[model samples]
Structure formats: C-alpha cells, structure tokens
Target chain A: MLPILIYGTTLGFTLALIAIGLSLVFGVARIINFAHGAFFAIASYTLYLFFITLNIPLPVSMILALISTATISVVMYIISLSRVRGMELNEMIITLAFTIIVIELLRIYFGPSPLGVPSFMKGGITIAGYVVDMQRIFIVVISIATLAALAFLVKKTRIGIGMRALAQDEDAAMLIGVNREKMCIISLAISAILAGIAGVSVTPIMTASLEGAWYALLNGIAIVILGGLGSLVGSLIAAFIIGYAEIIIATYVSSHLKSIVALIFIIVILILRPSGIMGRHHEIEERV
Target chain B: MKSRKESNKNIRTIRKERLDRGARARSKDLYVLMSYEDIAYVILPRVLPPLILLAFPFIVRDTYWHMVFFLAGYYAVASMSWDLLGGFTGLVSFGHSLFIGFGGYFTAILNVWYGVPIWLSIPIGTLAGAAMGTLIFAPCLRTKGVYFSLVSLVAPLVMVGSILAFAEITGGEEGIYGLENPLTELQWYYIMAGLVLLTFLILRKIAYSNFGLVLQAIRDNEPSVKVSGINPVRYKVTALFISGLFASLVGSLQAHKLSFVGPSYFYLSISVGIITMSVLGGVATIIGPAIGAYILTILTEWLRWLGGLRMLLYGVILLILLNFKPEGIYRYLERTYQTFERQVVEE
Candidate 1:
C-alpha cells in the first residue's frame, strides 16, 4: 500500500505536468495542438543528446532543452499554424502534421533505439519493508515544485492573467487590447516547454524513445478529455485518477491493461459527462 | 438633351434584358435537352469517371500498378465512409480505423477459428464492425461539439490496447498471419473497384435522400433540429452506423487482399489518412473522397523513393493542402465541370 501510494504520486505528478500543457493550449488557443506530445519526444531526445551524449550537467541540460523546445514551438506557430488560427479542423490536422514531422525528423536524426538519462539520485529508501528508489522521490519533488511554480506564475503574473483572459474569451480579450496572436505564441511556447520538462523528467524512468510521442500523445489526450479540455485543475485531478488507477490495475490485474485503463477512463468520462468533472459547459458548443 | 439621355438609358436596359434572356435560355438548355452540348456537359462528368474506373482493371496489367489501384480503391471506399459522417453529418471522426480494424480482425478471427469461407466472413465482419463502432460511440452521440471527435480520436487506440492485452486470443503483436489471400491481384482490383462504385452510389443516394437532409440539418444546427421534433441522437447514431458499415466493408476486403490482419490496421494514421483523402478530394461530395484517395495513394507511391521522409512529406502536403485548398479538388472539379460563366451586363 505504501509503495503504491509513493509510486502512484510519482506517476500522477509527471502525468499532470505532461497534460497541463495540452489543457492549457486547448484552453487559451482553442486548438488541440496534437503536436503537444512531439514536444515531449523533442525534450526527451534533447535530454538524451545533452545529459547522456554530451555529458552536460542535468540541470543545465534540462534548461537548454526547455528553451530549445519553446523556441521550436514559436517557429512552428509562425511558419505553419498562424494562418489557421481559429479554424478548428485545420488546426487539428496541421498540428497532427507537425507531430508527424517533428517525431519522424527526430527519429531520422536519433535513430529508433531507446536512450536513458541517468537518474538525478542514485540510491533507495526502505519503508514498511518496501524499497522506494530515491529517483522516484526526486521526481515527485521536482513535479510538485514545477507544478507549484506554474500555478504561481499563472495566478500572479501579468502574462498569466492575459492567458486566463484569452482562455475565457478570445474575442473579448482581444477587444480589451490583448494581442491574440501573441497570446497564442506565448501559450504554445509555454505548453511545449512544460511538455518538454515532463519528457525530460520521465526519460530516466520511462527511457526516452521516439515512441514517447505516441504514448505521450495518447496519455495527454486521455488526460485532457477526462479532466475536460481546458481545465488545468481538472486535468491535474484526472492525471492522479488515471495514474493511480493504472497502478492499481497493474498491481492487482495486469500491467498489460495500463493503457487500456486510460482509454476506458476517457470513454467513460466522455459518455457520462462530456463537460468533464469541473469544466465549463458553455465552451463545449464551438469545439466541433 | 433630356430626351437623348432617356433614349440612351432605354437602349442600355433593352440590351441588358436581351443578355439576361440569353443566359436564362442557356441554363434551361440542360433541363429541356435542346442541344448536344448541354447534354454532353451534364452527362460527361458523371458518366466518364465511372466508365474510366470500370475500365482501369483491364488497363493496369502490371502487378505493381495493380497493387496501387487496389490501395486507391481501398482509400476511396474508406474515404466515402468518412465523408458520410464527417462531410455530410459534421461528426468528424478520427478513430474511423476502429471500424476497419474491427472488420479485419473479426473476419480474420472467424476464418481462423470457424473455418468460415472468405465470402461469408466478409459480410459478417462488416456487420460486426458497424456494431462495435456504434456501441463504442453510442454513449457519446448526444454530447455536443467536438466531444464525439475527441472520443473517436482515441477509440481505435483503445481497441489497439485491448487487442494487445488479449494477445493470446488476438495472436499478440504480429497479429493473425498466414490467412489466405483469396483473390488474385487483378481480381482484388476489380472487386475493390466494384465495391468503391457500389459504396459511392449508395452513399450518394442516401445523401440526396430525405434522411440525408435531416443529417445535414443536424450538422448545421442540432438544437434547431431537435426543436423541429427530430431526434438528433437517433440520426447521429444511424449515420455513424452507416459510416462504420462502409468502412468495415473496405477493411474486411483489405484483410482478404493482404491475407492478414494486424494491430497496425488500427493505427491512428489510417484514420487521419482517410480524413486527408476526403478533405483533399472534397468534403460533402460522396465521390470526391474516392478521387482524393486515389490521388493521394498514387502520390504516396510516387514518393516511395523518399524512404523515411515519406511521412514528413505527407505531413507537409496535408498542411499545404489544408491551408490553400480547404475546399478540396472535388469542389474545383465540380465547379468547372458543372458551371458555365459568361458576361452579364447589370443595368
């Protein structure tokens, strides 16, 4: 039980980090940003190239990777996506295009083999006759700290307030002198950076690979849908629900069903209450 | 001076009336069948494409082109299905591969276990595919906006996980191989051609029918549709079922042609691929997606030399197409073929 809770929290926080960006993009931009997971892969690959291949210190390497990923997001928006800003279907398809382009390009460069980053810590702690790795504990700490930082930034900062305003009503925000295009750029960059950080943090645990794009994408979509498309708090809660749900399934049932658990959770939630547990019901009309 | 100006205005109005009368007469030429040109204009585009498609099997003798033609037919049929739900009903599904996958897997399973003949299994598999897709999506049919789309995007993925989880019965990762290829390459081509034509005509007929009107209404305004006493849920589900049925038919046929069914059949790429084909071909036109599918399939084949860059190329192409030609090639073709533009003097 102790082990499950410890490990589940670890999974939950990491999942939250990955999903919040997706939720954020959908909230503020009204675009699904299917390439959200591509950023995860890019971050993982970036971490692998730096911390593992180049022997850069982990902290320095992570910062560089996050910055690089954010830059890529800005360039991608300007080049391919800025024209299709409010067109929902085109945006989804174009982001899918970006996902395929980014992941495949990375695959060509890195090849298909999985690479691992060294854990931040190298030891374990035993509690209640169960061994808990220090890496897991460290991830939980890092995830919580990052999440707290994000919450603080969004709630307290001017840019964060602009983002919140845009998310609530883009036209209204624009009417009030918010630069809608700039907000999209900002949200996309931050979202990509957040996804990158999630990818970077999990590389040690999950082992970074090109397949992370697909897995992270599936997980991100599942989390956002269950938590509601644009609700940050709801996504956080859904991530824990899914993370612990999977751990429980893996514990008693079988690890094979872990992905299925997330999928089922999405289907069930969408069926039961499409607005999600805590999402606004009004914004649901324009999504189709 | 005033008499001269009035006389000039009368002359301009008389000339404009003469031009308008000529234009209206030309338009009535089609309905009245007054000339060979109008008759040819109306009949040529509709008849020629199908006639060419029918003659394609005989023209393509090479095994490679035969395979290409087969794939074109495959995408064409599937794209038609996608267009039905997405283009016509406005329920954009990204998990359409679930229907195809279900169809393929069930057909393969029935063949492996019950020794069912390929002929009988295909129909059963298609029905099963429709049933499975409908059941999976039924719960979300009443949900508003992109809720259905979101569920659909993940539906095939969930099926993939479920298939892999029950790999023991599902034959695991390699999927159920060693299945028989019941038809020769040429036979498969003709069969696919026939199937594509059949599916298109049926779907086209449905789209023009009263039922289709209701579906289009739902797409345009579901709340108003409900206000008009129509049950949007029932119509939406039926549309999905029909759409899934067609997709499954293609899937079942492809399984026999490929002689195997794998989890790869359920890949998200297939769903996106059909969507691209339909959008590029022209949405809302039952036949346009097939044309788009054929073009794209051949284009993909043409770019086969690019090796790993194929997907990157596909992504780039889709991005460009969506940005520039959101209405698709079908719309362009329909406009050029169906309309005659001439000078109209406004007075």
Candidate 2:
C-alpha cells in the first residue's frame, strides 16, 4: 500500500505535467493542438540527439532541447495553426497531421527502438524498506516545484492576467488591449516547454521512443477530457485520479490493463457528464 | 450604357460563367432536349466515370496493379461511409477504424472459432459490427461537436488494449490468421468496384432525398431541426447505422480478401487517412470522398519507395490543402467542368 501511494503520486505528478500543457492550450486558444504530443516527443528526442549523440553537457543539452521545442511550437503556431484559428475541425486535423509528421520523422531518424537515457542522479533510496529510484523522487520534487511556479506565474504575472482575460472572453480581452495572437504564441511556447520538461524528466523511466508521442497524446487527451477541456484544476485532479487508478490496477491486476484505465475514464466521464466535474460549459449538452 | 458586346470589346477583362447556367435556363420547366450537346453534357459525366471504373480491372490486367486498385476501392467505400455521417450529419468521428476493426474481428472469430461459412458470416458480421458501432456511439450522440469526436478517438485505443488483454481469444499480437481468401484477384476487384458504385449512387440518392436534407439540417442547426418537429437523434442514429453498415461491409470484405484480422485494424492512421480523403475530395459530397480516396490511395502506393517519408508527405499535403483549398478538389473540378469564362467590360 505504501508502494502504491509513493508510485501513484510520482506517476500522477508526471501525468499532470504532460496533461497541463494540453489543457492550457485548449483553454486559451480554443484549439485542440493535437501536435502537443509531438512536443513531448520532440523534447526527449532532441535531448537524446544533443546529449547522447553530440556529447553536449547534460544540463546544457536539456536547456537546448527545451529551447528548440519552444521555437518549434511557436513556428508551428505561426505556420499551421494561425491560418485555421477558429475552425475547430481544421485545427484538430492540421495538428493531428503535424503530430504524425513529427513522430514519423523521429522514427526515421532515431529508428523504431526505444533509446535509454541515464538518470540525473544514479542509485535508489530505500523508503519503508522498499527501494525507489532517486530519479522518480527527483521527478516528484521537480514536478511539484514546477506546478507551484506555474501557478504563481499564471495567478500573479501580467502575462497570466492577460491570458486569463483572453481565455474568459476573447473579444472583451481584445477590446481591453490584450494581443490575441501574441498570447496564443506565448501560450503555445509555454505549453510545449511544460511538455518538454515532463518528457525530459520521465525519459529515464519510460525510455524515449516513437510510441511516446501516442502515449503522451492519448494520456493527455484522456486527462483533459475527464478534467474538463479547459479547466486546469480539473486536469490536475483528474490526472491524479487516473495516475493512482492506473498504478493500483497495475499493482493488483494484470499490468497489461494499465492503459485501459485512462480510456475507460474518458468514455465514462464524457457519457455521464459532458460538462465534466468542474466545468461550467453545459453548452455541450444536447438541447431538447 | 454601352452595348454588351461593345462593352466586352471595350475592356479586356475576363468573366467566368457556368456553362450549365445556359443549359439550366434552356431546360427549365420542360421535357425537351435542346440538342445532342445538352444530352452529352448531362449523360457523359454521370455515365463515363462508372463505365471507366467498371472496365478498370480489364484495362489494367496486371495482378499487382489490380491489388492496388482494389485497396483504393476499399478506402473509397469507407470514405463514402464516413461522408454520410460526418459530412452530412456533422458528427466528425476521429476513430472510424473502430467499425472497421469490429467488422473484421467479428468475421474472423465467426469463421475461425464458430466454423461459420464465409458467405454466411460476412453479412452477419457486417450487421453485428454496425450494431456494435451504433450502440457504442448512441450515448455520446447527445453531446455536440468535439465531444463526440473525443469519445470516438479514445474508443479504438480502448479496443486495442482489450484485445491484448483477451489474448487467448484475439490471438494477441500475431492476430487471427489462416482464414481463406476464396475469391480471385479479378473477382475481388470487381466486387470492390461494384461496392464503390453502389455506395456512391445510393449515398448520393440519400443525400439529396428528404431524409438526407433533414440530416443536413441537423448538421447545420439542430435546434432549428428540433423546432421543425424532427428528432435529430433518431435521424443521426439512422445515419450512423447506415454509415457503419458500409464501413463494416468494406472491413469484412477486406478481412476476407486478406484472410487476416488483427489489432492493427484499429490504428489511428486509418481513421486519419479517411478523414484526409474526405476533406480532400470535398466534405459532404457523396462522390467527392470516393475520388479523394482513389487519388490518395494511388498516391500512397506510388510513393512506396519513399517509405518513411510517405507519412511526412501526407502531413505536408494536408497542411497545404487545408490552408489553401479547404473546400477540396472535387468542388474545384466540378466548377471548372461546369463553368465557362469570357472577358467582359465593366458596366
């Protein structure tokens, strides 16, 4: 039980890190940004390339990868997403298309096999007589710190205030001098960097592979939907719910059933309450 | 004002007009044919494409190329099915491979495990698959827009996991094989061509019919449809069932043709491929998606050497198409074929 608690919280934090970016993009831009998963893939793949292939120093490689990911995210917004801004369906398709391109390109360059990345701090620490990797513990601490920093950034910063205004009402915010396009670009970069952080931290545990795109994508979508499309708080809570549920299912049941938990959650939540747990957008409900 | 011909001569400006406009004006409220040109105009487009499709197998005669055409025809039929629900009814499904997977798996299980005859199992499997799709989608039909799409996108991923969990029955990663491909390549080709023609004509009829109009109205505005005394859910359900039927038919046929059914049948790429086809051909046009499917399928086959670069190409093309010609090629082709242009002077 203690093992489950420790592992679940770790997993939950990592999942939250991956999903918050997706939720953030959807909330501000009203775009699904399907390529968001590719952002996660891009970060880890670039990290692998720079650190392992180029022999760059570890810290610098990580920073380079994160910066490159942010640049690509903004470029993607300017190139593909900006053109089809409000057309919901086109945005989804173009982004999905972009994701396929990125993942396949990674496969072409990196080959299909998963590549191992060494952990930041070697060795494991025994907790309550069960040994846990130092990396997992590091991930937990880092994720919490990042979340707190993000909260402060969104809650108190001028950019955060403008982002909040844009999200709540785009036209009203525009009237008040918030730049819509600039906010979109900034939000996309921030979201991509967040995914990059998650990908970099978790790569040692999961290993980096082409499948990570789908993994990140499916989990991100699952959490975002269950948490409510645009609600960060809901995403945080839902991520933990799925994280703990997955760990418990894997522990008690067959490990093969792990991924099904998120999918099932998505289906059930969407069917039972389209507006989600904390969302106020009952507009999704059927009329008559 | 200058005379029309003089004005046209005065300015070297070009004016575009629909050639059909003249034919339409001539044929208004009448049962008479103006000339052979009129008869040719109406008859050629409708008849020529089907005739060419019917003769394609004979025209090609090569087994390898025949196989490619057969695959294209399968995508064509599936795209048409998708067009019915997504284009007409506005229920954009991102996981259409679910129906295809169900259809294939049902046939495989029925034939392999239950000892059912191929002929008997195909129809039963198709029906069962369609029913299963309808049942799964029925609950989410109440939710609008991306909610339905989200449910659809996740459902197939769930199926993949479930299949792996039930490895004893599903054959796990190796999938269920050893089923028979009883039909010859030529026979399969003809069957596929026949299905494409039948689906196109039938879906076209439905789209222009009163029932199809109601579905379109639901897509455009559901509340107005409700105010007009139509139950949008019922129409949507029927459309979904019909759409699922064609999609399942193609899946069952493909499974039998390949003599295999596997978890990969539910891959997201297939769904994305069909959506790309529908959008490229012109959404909501029953005939357009078929054309788009054939074009894309052939293009995919031709780019076989590119291998890894092929999907990248698809992404680029989709991006370019969505940015530049979101209306798709069929609409553009139709306009060019039906319209004529002339230079005219400004009045």
Candidate 3:
C-alpha cells in the first residue's frame, strides 16, 4: 500500500512537470499544442540517439537532445501556430497536423519500436518497507526543482511577465510593447524544453518509443482540460488527481484500462464542469 | 496607323462593354443552364469523376491497385462524413473511428450471432451506429469546441478498452475474423463504387440545401442561429447521425470485404487519416473528401516502397497542404475553374 502511494506521488510529480508545460502553452498561446507529445517522444529518441547510438557524453547528449526539441518547437511554432494564432479551430488543427508529422517521423526513423535507456542513477532505498529507486527520487527532485525555477521565471523575470501579459490579452500585451511573437517563441520554447526534460528524465523507467508521443499528448490533454485549459495551479492539482487515480487503476485493476481512466476523467469533467476545479466558471462558456 | 474610323468603329462596336454570350452564361448560376457550355460546366464535374471511379476496376487490372481503389472509395465515404460533421457542421471530431468501429463490431455481432444476412445486417448496423453515435455525442454538444473535441478524441480509446475488457465476445486483441461476404470480389468493388457515388450525390445535395445552410450558420454562430428560431442541438445531432450513418455503412462494408472486424478500427490513426484526407481534399466541398481519399490511398500504395519514410513523406505532404491551402485540392480546383474575375464597372 505504501509502495503504491510512493509510486503514485512520483508519477504525479512527473505528470505535473509535463502538464505544466502544456498548460503554459495553452494559457499563453491559446493554442492546443498537440505536437507537444512529439516533443516528448523525440527528446528521448534524440537522447537515445546521441547518448547511446553515437556514444556521446551523457550531459552533452542530454543538452543536445533538449536543444534539438526546443529547435523543433520553435520551428513548429513559426510554421504551424504563428499564422493561426488566436483561432481555436485553426490552432488545434495545425497542432494536430504537426503532431502527425512529428510522430510519423519518429516512427519512420525508429522502426516503430521502443528503445531502452539506461538509468541515470542506480540502486534503491527502502522507504516504509517499499524499495524505491534512487533514479525515481532523482526524478522527483528534478521535477520539483524545475517547477520552482519555472515559478521564479514567471514571477520575477521580464520575459515571463511578457508571457503572462500575452496570455491575458495579445492586443493589450502588444500595446504595452510585450512583443507577442517574441513572447510566443519564448513560451513555446520553455514548454517544449520542459516536455523534453520530462521525457529524458523519465526514460530509465520507460523505454522511449513512437507511441510515447501519444501517451504524453493524451496525458497532457487530460490534465490541462480537466484542470481548465490554461490554469497552472489547476493543472498541477488535476495532475495529482489523475496521476494517483491512474496508478490506482493500474495497480488494482488491469493496466490496460489505465488510459480509460483519463478518458473517463475527461468525459466526466467536461460534462459536469467544463471550467474545472479552480478555473473561473464564466471565463469561457461551456458551449462556444 | 491609327485611323479615326477604326477608333470610332471599335468604340461603337464595344457597345458600353456588354457581356458576350460566354461571359453572360458564366455570370448565371449553373441551374439556369443558359447554353451547352453551362450544361457541360455543371454536369461534367459531377459526372466525370464518378464515371472514372466506376470504370476504375476495369482499368486497374492489378489486384493490388483494385484493392487500393476499393479502399479509396471506402475512405472517401468516411472523409466526406468528416467534412460534413467538421467543416460544414462545426463539430470537429478528433476520433471519428468510434462510429466506424461501432458499425463494424455491431454489424459483425448482428451477422454472426443473430444469423442476420449480410444484406440486412449492413443497414441495421448503420442505423445502430447512428443511434449510438448520436446518443453518446449529443450531450457533448453543450460543451465548447475544445471539450467536444476532447470527448471525441477519447471515445475510441474508451471503446478499445471496453472491447478488450470484454475479450470473450469482442475477440479482444485477436478480433473476430472470417465474417461472411455476400458478394464476389468484383461485385463488391462495383457495389462499393455505386455506394460511394450514391453517398457523394446525397451528401452534395444535402450540403447545398437549406438544411446545409442552417448547419453552416450554426457553425458560424450558434447563438445567432438560436435567435433566428432554430434549435442548434437538433441540427448538430442530425449531422452527427448522418455522418455516423455513412461512416458506419462504409465501415461495415470494409469489415465484410476483409472478412474481419478488429479493435484496430478504433485506432486514432483511422480518425487522423480521415481528417487528413478531408483537409487535403478541401473541407466543406461535398466531393473534396472523396477526391482527397482517392489521392491519399493511391499515394500510400505508391509510397509503400519508401517503408518508414512513407509516413514521414505523408506527414510532410499534409503539413504542406494544410499550411499552404487548407481548403484542399477540390475546392482549390473549383475556385480556379469556376470563378470569374471580370473587372467591376466604376458605378
């Protein structure tokens, strides 16, 4: 029981890290970045390619992989999201379009298979009679640190302020000299890089594969939508709720039904309260 | 060399820039059919494609290409429904395979378990599909576009899980194989082709009618539509039913043709491919999805040699198409061929 609790918490934090980026992108850019999942997949894929396949140093490989994903995100932003900015349908369609392209590219190059990644840290420590890996602990630490840093960036930095301004209103932000395009590039980069880190960090636990994008896409979407499309606090809370629920389902029932938990969660929440737990009820009407 | 007589005659002959016969004919709606050219313009586009598609089996003697053509017609039907539901009706479904898979499984169950004949089962399955789809998605109509899409995106995934959980009946991952096909391969092709043409004509007529206009208005602004005394819910539900009916119809056809029904029909890729085909063909154009599906199915067959690169190129092609001309190939052609750009008089 304790093991399940510990595992669920770890899963929750990891999801928080991933969901935060997705939430940020949606909040600021007002576009659902479906290709965010492809970022997760390719980050781990490139990490595998650079670190193991090409025999590069681990740190260098990680940085290079993260950089590569960021580059793709920026390029994707310019090509796909930039022109269709502020329109929900166009944005969603373009992002889904890029997602297909990215996931397909991953499949073509990777032979539609899952590839393993060696652990960043080895060994385990017992906590409450549950043996937990040091790498899992490391992931928890990294996620928390990343979250802290993101909070700081958003609270204290100028670019972060610009992002917040843009999220609230693009025309107003531009009027205040926020540079909407620049803010978009920066926010998308951060979002993509966070996804990259989440994927790379979690690689030791799960083999990176083409379908990882699908998993991340669905997970991120379920979390963000349930927590309200653009609310960070809501996403964080919703992530834990969904994460624990998913883990519990996997543990108690069949793991095959884990995705169904998210599916059901989305449907239930969408039907019951589209604003989510912490979101303003009247921000956007349930019906458009 | 200019003469006063030539200038004066040219000015007089111009007659205040009156429209010639061809120009006048072009100005009138096709319904008028003012001349032979007008009749050709209206009838050619509608007749030629279907004729070519009907003649395809005879021309493409290769078994593989025949299969490709058959699949093209199948995909055309599905994408057309998607274009209607999404592009025209403003309900963007990210996982439309729910209807397709539902159609396949329900038809399979009805035929195999209930001893229903294939002929009877198909229509029954389509009706069941429509009813199930409308019942399930009708509530979601109250939600915004994103939430509606979210429900759609997960509906198939849920279907898969439920199917797997009930593996005893669903056949689970292995799926039910060797269902009956009532017709021979050639007959199936011609029949499917006939169904495809029939679907095209029906959908096109509906799209241009007052019903289609109301649906389009709801897509633009539901409140305004409601203010104008139309229930958006009724139209949205109807659109879903119509769309699901055809999707299910084609899906059942596919299952019988393959003699199998599997959980793979619930795959999101099927939905994605349909959307890609619709967008490539040009959304809202009644026949664009059909054209898009044909081109894509053939493209996939040709690109099979590329192996993994096939999908990469496919993705790239979609990116190019969506980014450059989201209206799709059919609409693009329609605009180019049908549109006139005569200069306006200053008055």
Tens digits of per-residue lDDT, candidate 3, A130-232, equal: 7899888988898889899999999899988988888777789889898777777888899998999899998878889876787888888888878887889
* DockQ for the candidates, in order: 0.54, 0.53, 0.51
lDDT per residue (tens digit) for residues B152-256 in model 3: 876786788778877888889988887788677788788778988889889989888999999899888887888998888888888889999999998888888
What lDDT does candidate 2 reach at residue A72?
93
lDDT of 1 by residue, A1-288 (tens): 886798789888888988999999888888888888899999999988888888899899989889989998899899889888767667777888888888778878888788877788888999788888888887788888888988988999988899999987778899998888888899899899888888888889988898788878888888888888899999999999988998998898877787888778877887788778768777666553
List runs of model 2 lying over 4 Å from the truth: A281-288, B1-33, B342-347
Model 1 Cα shift for residue B247 (angstroms):
0.6
Candidate 1 error regions (>4 Å): A280-288, B1-26, B30-39, B178-181, B338-347
How far in Å is the alpha carbon of B144 misplaced in model 1? Answer: 2.5
lDDT of 1: 0.84
Question: 2 or 3: which has the higher lDDT?
Answer: 2
Q: Write down the lDDT of every candidate, Cα atoms only.
A: 0.84, 0.86, 0.82
Ten-residue stretch with the least lDDT total in model 3 chain B: B15-24
State model 3's lDDT: 0.82
Instruction: Point out the higher-scoring one by DockQ: 2 or 3.
Output: 2
Q: What is the number of backbone collisions in each predicted candidate, taken in the order shown?
A: 0, 1, 2
Kept native contacts, fraction for each prediction: 0.68, 0.61, 0.45
Model 3 misplaced stretches (Cα beyond 4 Å): A286-288, B1-23, B26-42, B58-64, B339-347
